[model samples]
Target chain A: MADEDATDEPQGPRTTTAEIVPLRLPPVADEEPEPLEDPRTGDVDEWGRSERVRALVRKAYDPMYRNWFRAEWDGLDKIPTEGGALLVANHAGAIPSDAPTIMHGVETELERPVYGLADHFFKSAPVVGTLWSRTGGVVAHPDNAYRLLHDQNQLVLVFPEGSKGPGKTYNERYRLRRFGRGGFVEIAMRAGVPIIPIAVVGAEESMPILFKVPSVARALGAPYFPVTANMALGPLGALIHFPAKFKLRVLDPVTFPDVEPDQPRYSRSRIMDESEAIRQQIQEALFDMLRQRRSVWFG
Target chain B: MGRRVLVTGLSTFWGGRVAQALEADPDVDVIIGLDTREPTVKLERTEYVRSDENYSILSRIVKATGVDTIAHTFLVVDSTTMSSRAMHEINVIGTMNLFAAASAAGSTVRKVVVKSAALVYGSSPKDPYWFRETDRRVAPARTRVERSLLEVESYVRDFARDNPHVVLSLLRFCNVVGPDITTPLTRALRLPLVPKVAGYDPRFQLVHEDDVVAALLFAIDREVPGIYNVAGDGQIPWSEVMTIAGKRGIPMPPFGIGLATDPLQRLGLVDFAPEVIDLLKYGRGIDNRAFKDAGFAYEHTSAGAVEAFVQAMRLRDTVGSDEVDYRYEEDVETFFRHSPAVVRDTPPS
Candidate 1:
């Protein structure tokens, strides 16, 4: 019976299949053959980013981007036409509209793909995670960032403040959160990419968090559950953002000449200093943008 | 002067396939296959040696046969196939003994090629888009298969470190799909409605079984002494993979998937193990560039592997179960190999 089972196993089918379809032999060492055509049926790339999905999303969100926020960009040309750059920005609002605004703006203006690096929390959610990935959101892992900036030579947008920026109450809106252990700076240094800081205004007011329900957040295994002013509009408020004039100011690209790329480790103090300087620059830029802004609803 | 090779788990798919490939090479003078059961595949010149799962007599065989290359393909990456304890014995203890024998005093083993799975990099939401060889698992292994594989790899790592002279290469292959191999993913794809985690379309990296065997051969031939991830180029989402296979996905509840699959397992419908469930949720991708850099070319991309598997499935459906012609008869093989009456054309080296 065991012998029968053994005979019934792979050998028979494998040989028969070999007769039908010729076995592909490995190419000789020097002469590499053309790679087998990838039979991918979807547009999703290795990073889970889909141009088709992004285009569809851009189409749906364009009305909100143009009319609702009326997002305006200053010194957009300061971003390089080519090569990799880490676009560091201040994150805010209940859901953080700044990321999409910046990504959509830069993608539309410069015609380059901008990958928004967010917390892995987005990836844990079922439908949300899939949507986030398809629409060009990658987890903010140093390895993922390095590959994006160095190997792929693609523009990456990251919020150094992280969930803290979005988790803050309405009162603590513009105040910058502590930059995450300066890991982003280290990644930029290692990837041999310059850090381009951008200050975003009106995101804090877009969906201002009145308060947070910690118990509910803990129960739901969420980062934070925020009760925003939009909640006053009832259930739909969670998805809706107030029409705040979104103004983005791009600062000069900061490069690290002293530190070498692909180092196992960089100077801790150096990373911290660079991170703090970028934060300060963005903070100052935010205040300047806010000062120039005549009104919240209209710029 | 030719290579004397020892292949573990001869009865298993990988072991039999590898031994068969080794037999075709004129340089491989002696092929001694070790397994508890008779080899499933018929081979011309390979000698089969029945051994316990832990390989108690491996040292004696290694010393007596003077096999220079050991292809360790006995590690169980699929948890659903056997009990946890049995799997532990085969994967962990089997590997421990194999390495012990290879590293024994004055051992003739010069090269060791292990067929490991990409399960070492656990599927998780925290994982990078592509796991490089250097990247450690984002989370601690929860399943028995993963834990056992991890333990086996640690042994391999230690063995490599201790025996610097031995050209030890650990090839971590991703989910493999092809005509001959049967894996959880392939089994699922074969189903009428491929089971998926609801609302999660994870990207999976699949390699062809041929690529896997070729990678093992590549490692053995070149004597590459580093861990390499052997996966097909590119990753395809689960939905896309299903579409390519011409099957619609039947989604299991995202939470409490065990509740749904337990009954299926009871009914012998599908064996959805915990690790496979996690994989269904968040599929894994590993960087195949390292092996490619070492001059090993893959015949199938991830999607190509799926296409090949689907094509083979279609063929099987048309062919009405392949007829098993070559049955392993011990006496016949023995007579052919050792009979003095038989004329010797190409004498054993």
Candidate 2:
């Protein structure tokens, strides 16, 4: 089995020869082929969002969007029809109808897809996750946000308060939660996209959380188990909304001109300041919209 | 003098394919393949050396052969093929010994290309839509395969750090599917009823087997160092994959799925490895742009790979596997490679 002689005898003088053979060759410039056709059987995209599903959802949800919520948008023109922008909204209600209302309104009005960046908690559930993904719900990861905002150049709607905004009691309605350590600001800064603050009214009254049972939430492994005023109707109330009017106002786009995009890290104080400023702008807008409101159901 | 390369796992599908590919490369003069078993594929000039599962004799072989490039393809990513103990031996221990041999004092090896799987990134609901090369797993590995692969990667990282002069490229390939390769996913897809977790349709990123070999060769040909994700362009949902295969899916219960699959596994109905189950739940997507930026072109997308596999399946169903079963005969191979009476094509250098 001493076969080294057979292999090595042909190639003589291994030492000087080793020096001539380069360890790393110059990379061969492969002729780039025309992109192959993706043989996909479904419309689900790389982000799991499906346009066909989104369109179908819009068709079915249009009635509820127009009638039940009566979702109305102000300063919708302020949102750029093209290019990427982070749509920051104040979340409310036990189920938080604002995300869908805002997404449905922007998508229908702008005639563009709007990806709702939600908690990964939605992704953990089986049917809900699949439905959420098909209807344009993306997990609110910084990378996911950056890719959507910068790479794909799509509109992304995120509630800065996360589950905290909706998980609060009915008395805490319209009060904005802390904006999640300003991660959204950092992501927008990294993506170099402007943050468009959207203030919403009547989401608080739609499915108001009377109180939350932490024990039940813990048992169910949920963020919060809410006892909503809508639940007084029946078990179906969990899915039903109280027919509260939804009025949404898209605030001016906030651009971080001073900071460079794609930075490894941003100034902590700068992120906090920018995050607080955006929160305050949305809070004030909500109060302004609420002051002009006649009735929760009527808006 | 041309390149002398050492390929691990000569009998395994990847190792045999890689060795065969290297044999076709005129630049690579000497090809030595190491595995516990004999080479499974036909080769002309490559030399196969039998070694134990842990490759304890790798250092001696490395020194004797003076191989400059080592293509480590032996790491077992499929846990169903062996026991956890054997997998640990092959993946973790074998990798440790191989790296040890390569990075030894006065070692001739300068470049190392590791064929790693994207399973190192454990699939979880919290995972980003796309995992960059630098992204860590959202959760720790739960299965033996993932854990073992992770361990092998750590050794690769350490070897790279210790031997900075050695150009090391770690190619993390996503779920590979094509006409030839038989992975857990492919096996499941080939079943009469493709098993899926109930109410969960996760998107999967797939690469064709040809692209996988091409990526490995590309890494060897170029000086592209660092971790590069080797996958096709886009992701396809599991349901769409079954649809492309022209097969219906049978949903496995979402809860206690491991317990549910045990009986089927014993009955040879389905081979749902624990890692694959997690993959079927919250599928993985790796960022393949880094490899593309490194100038490797992929021939198939996620869906295209499935299409290729399905097309092959259709043909196989009609013709019943046209592959000629070639067995390795040591005496015949030795005579062809070493016998003095045999006429040489290249005139002995």
RMSD for each of the candidates: 6.2, 4.4
Chain A TM value for model 1: 0.90
TM-score of 1: 0.95
Looking at candidate 1 chain A, the ten consecutive residues that score lowest on lDDT are A11-20
Candidate 2 stretches with Cα past 4 Å from truth are A1-33, B262-270, B347-349
For candidate 1, give the lDDT.
Answer: 0.88
Model 2 achieves a DockQ score of: 0.39
CAPRI grade, predicted model 1:
acceptable
TM-scores for all predictions: 0.95, 0.95
Clashing pairs in 2: none
